[model samples]
Target: MSTVACPDCEARVSLDTPVLNEIVECAECRSELEVLSTDPVVLGRAPEVEEDWGE
Candidate 1:
């Protein structure tokens, strides 16, 4: 497991065998975060969900 900072709440989060581009939720702020890197444990805000009308 690795520790990463939350972009929204700046809280420490533990990632268990995280992968690149994996989506995770911040425990403190409950914000959706995306895994940008795994070496140093980088996290970013997840992209906004877009509505699909049977496209």
Candidate 2:
């Protein structure tokens, strides 16, 4: 298992074979986290999903 610190809460999150662009949730803050990289296991805040009005 790989451990990485949550960018929002600074809590340790364990990942099992995490991949790039994978979305994960933080247990402490419950914020969505995105996998920026996998080599060193870097994590960042996930972008909020917005709906398009067929524009």
The parts of candidate 1 lying over 4 Å away from their true place are 52-55
C-alpha lDDT of candidate 1 relative to the true structure = 0.92
Q: Tens digits of per-residue lDDT for model 1 on 1-55?
A: 9998899989998999989999999888899999998888899999999999889
Clashing pairs in 2: none
In candidate 2, how many Å is residue 50 off?
0.9
Candidate 1 lands at a TM-score of 0.87
Error of 1 at 36 (Å): 0.5
Task: Score every model by TM-score.
Answer: 0.87, 0.95
In model 2, which regions exceed 4 Å deviation? none
Counted clashes in each candidate structure: 0, 0
The most accurate candidate by lDDT is: 2
lDDT (C-alpha, whole model) for all candidates? 0.92, 0.95
Predicted structure with the largest TM-score when compared to the true one: 2
Q: Candidate 1: worst 10 consecutive residues by lDDT?
A: 37-46
